[model samples]
Target: MEHRITLNAIAHIRSSFPEKFGIPRQGGLADTRGNIVFEPEYRDVQAFRGLEEYSHIWLVWEFSETLGRQWSPTVRPPRLGGNIRKGVFATRSPFRPNPIGLSCVRLEKVELDTPEGPVLHVLGADLLDGTPILDIKPYLPHVDSHPEAAGGFADRVKEYGLEVDFPRELGAEVTEEERRIICQLLAQDPRPSYQQDPARVYGMRYADLEVKFTVNHETVHVVKIIRSMPD
Candidate 1:
């Protein structure tokens, strides 16, 4: 016999990312800030009581864009340099039998009693702005924190730092703090390892500036950054 499950969205994340290509492959990878605005119907101020006690929360959401009417059994992971294929069930690739995604985000603060309703201030969210959130649960450290947990296939993942050489013309417009944040973000190496063409310039928008960088081996070196013009 076949079983089925049904889920509903509780809120939607509001972030600066509008495209899938640039979203950090994993949530909380950016260490950048964003907001999780609950739907008006679920925005009861009382519902948030004691939520501030926890520093992080788990988000259950859908890969809404990855699904249609079909599914694939194999996928290429960017972590694997996007070359070799892997079984969909073994990887977090979005093209799964069920396109569900999970993320653990740090809770910065909770703003309550607002005219619009309660809002959750979150940090390090890799979710795109307006990504539908299916459910939220407080992270229980005693149960969730497992230092010995084995991360298969991803065990070889290496940490890297950014080598940004900001252009003088653009550097003058960006504040020192902004530069620091951008550098930290680029250090995570946002590009797929398979993509190693040095001549290509890749960019992503953070706050008010458009940051461009190139990858050489394991290094992500910043090339230029400009203040984004207002739309």
Candidate 2:
């Protein structure tokens, strides 16, 4: 016999990452901010009465874009240069059997006076705009914290912080908050590990700007910044 499970979306995330290309690989990788807007039916303040006590929360969400995509036993992770294949269960590939994702994000504040209902402001979230949230649970440090846990292959990978250079003129146009977040994202080296052509420029859709950059080893130079037109 087999059992099936069904879940309802309690809230949705509102973020600057409208697309998936430039999203950080993991939550808390960048100081990017997002808002969790509860669904009308689940907007009661009583549901989140004691939620503000926790510093962090876990968001169980769906990979809506990859919902219908086929799943494979193995996947190529960007961290591995997109060339080496690892067991899908060992990697955080969006192409999963269930198309589900879990993220731990900083819970900044909980507002109960929103017009639609209660809203949760979060920081360091890597979710895309309008991502459906299935459940919200408070993170317990005493029970969840495991300092001695091994990271498996992720621990063996050499990490490098890319030096990001934004042109003075274009850099001036970006706000301090945007600049900080963008730089942090670039520091993580947002490129396929296998593609390392210094001459080749990469375009990433970030927020309302088209960020053009080129990476040559340890450095990422921002060549141009084009404002995306409104839809």
Per-residue lDDT of model 1, residues 145-219, tens digit only: 999999878777665565656566766778877776677677777777677798889987776678888877656
Error of 2 at 223 (Å): 0.9
What lDDT would each prediction earn against the true structure? 0.79, 0.90
| Per-residue accuracy of model 2 over 1-231 as CA lDDT, tens digit each | 878998889999999998887788889889999999989999988999999999999999999999778999999888887878999999999989898999999999999998979999999899989999999999999998899999989998878688999888988877888888888988888887888899999988778988889998799999988886778
Alpha-carbon runs more than 4 Å astray in model 1: 167-169
For all candidates, what are the clash counts? 1, 2
lDDT, candidate 2, equals: 0.90
